[model samples]
Target: MPPFDQTRFRLPRGARADAVLAGGVFVVVALGAEGQRLSHGEDSAPSQIASWLLIAAVCGTLLFRRRYPVTAGWFTVLGTGAYYLLSDIDGPLVIVPIVALYALAAQGRMQAAIGMAAAMIIGMAAITLAGSSDVTGTAVFMLTGWLVAVVALGSARHSRLAYAEEEARLRATEERLRIARELHDVIGHNISMINVQAGAALFRLKKDPAQAEEALGAIKASSKETLRELRATLGVLRRVDEQAPTAPAPGLARAAELVASAQLAGLPVRIERTGPERSLSAPVDLAAYRIVQESLTNAAKHSGAGQVTIRLAYGDRELALDIEDDGQGSAARPAGSGGGSGITGMTERARALGGELTAGPRPEGGFAVRARLPYGTTGKPMERSDR
Candidate 1:
């Protein structure tokens, strides 16, 4: 035998599913009523037919349960009562109203569902007490328990769905922020370099033709590099079925490239290492590289600095970065103080990986950005005093 696919039996929402549910309820209740009529043989043919019609009417109300939940619930409750009062045959027709009660609660009509359920239970209890109904007290108690359970289940499902939607919305917001930071870092750094080179080329066009030619060449190279990085960043947003990019992401291994670009923009940059080098996690490596790139760009554009120094320190648990420049120090614009997001973006990147970054003008007369990033696993973010 083939394996069964349970999904095939799962009813979809809408009129078709409602019709199927109501039809199934009618068939079940009719069969039970017929069985009772045959076994008792007390109801006349006309009376039995009336009972079947009443059962069908009550079950049919379920077809509109999702569209007008409160209205359908009341209809089924009153119809079931009429079926008991007019028919001689006893059956399981009360289930239709129970299904409608659950639908009402699931649609967030809790007050109406509870009201209908209370009315049904009280009316049934009154008829039984008056010596006109055959339903036992125990049956009424069990029915009350079932109604409560169904309403509770519906409310729980609603809460779960709401939580899932909120979580998905939060994830989407975080992804957009990450993408924005990447674009700012990649495009901003290169464009600033190109602008500086263009200005230099224009200033020396006639007085120093060779120097002007070199500046123009640097501008062309920077522009080409900008396009490549931009394409790589945008590729991440493409659909899964599309071909993915093959280029590696920028990391500390490309620190030399940033140095060369900074030099072309007329800022001298030197890299110094203090400890043995070791491979870093992708996130940490990228964060470190971007911090360096942004710092160098700032030095070239804003800081009247003669030289910039980048120092890397490797330890057993963390990698530390120090980028300082012999610039105008406190006289220069502070990081992120000029409405630029470079410093803010760099700080966000570091903190996201359980790291800490601080950028400030040094008391000794230069600007410095310092950061410490951990390896694979997340650790407590170090405090400023610890740094």
Candidate 2:
């Protein structure tokens, strides 16, 4: 039975819930008024009937409390005053107005709620001073406290709900950005290789059939990898209630594959490692791999480089990456600065892991992307201070 989805049977909210609450308050106030009338035996029948009608009207205002909080708040306050004036019994009818005040404050009407609460407190104090009815000064003081508490609780509820909504929005934005980066890294790199191999195949097809066949094979491999990675990336969005993906995310372990693919795409790549090799956290590893992949893609597509070098320096607390291509000095732009998000995405990834990435043309006649990624840290990355 699907575990009986408790949310499906939870208490109502909004208008329907207000209706329920109004009905419950009406019953309680009505019973209290009737008991007081019986105990006093001084109120006339007409007055008693008028008090019941007033109670009904005041409680009915709660039905629109959520939809029209301010209007209902004022109506309930005034209606309660009328109820007291018409009826000899001081019952629990004030509860309706208190609830209305809460609704007003919860709807972000702090000014109006505070105003109405002050008016009620002052009016009660005036009545106590005038010596009308049996209500005491202490009762008025208690009512002030109740009103203050209700407004405070309502405002707190509003702030909490606002914060939760903002948090949800931020999470959604982060997820979208993550998906976009993944798609670009997975599909963009493979597609660029496919395009280059297709061009090479067409250029050699007439004169060199064997070379063209090799290029076609490279194209086929690139396409197959593209589809596989694309499917895996999209599968994450489709799986909401299913088991998490068992496949490991692409990390530094796959750097050799990237190098091989770039080589097939006619870009020579050499990887130099320094310091002892060590495992890294998943996020840091993924970021490092993606930074390398994006740098290579940019080089293959934009940089007219005959050779590229990727250096990895492992340290006790940080990993440093340096990818430099000996391409045309003026033509080498890190991650194709011509309106693509490649470099931006890579920089965001590094920064999210408490790291820094810098990409620009090197003074020594090439383009370089240098990054310093912390091993594990709780601090956020400082703002991007270097291009």
RMSD of each: 5.0, 5.4
What's the alpha carbon RMSD for model 2?
Answer: 5.4
Error of 1 at 197 (Å): 2.2
Write one digit per residue (lDDT tens) for candidate 2, span 1-387: 558888779898777798799999999998998889789887887987898889989999888877777888899889998888778998899999898888778878999899889988988998899997677899898999999999999999999989999999999999999999998888888898888778888989999999889889998988988887777766678865655556567898789889988887789999988776767888998999999999898888888799999999988789999999988654646354645689899999999988899988889877899999998952232233221
lDDT of 1 by residue, 224-262 (tens): 989988777666676445465565678887898889888
CA lDDT, every prediction? 0.84, 0.86
Off by over 4 Å in 1: 1-13, 42-50, 131-133, 240-246, 328-340, 377-387
RMSD in Å for candidate 1, one decimal? Answer: 5.0
- TM-scores for all candidates: the values are 0.84, 0.91
User: Candidate 2 has which clashing residue pairs, if any?
Assistant: none
Best candidate (score: TM-score)? 2
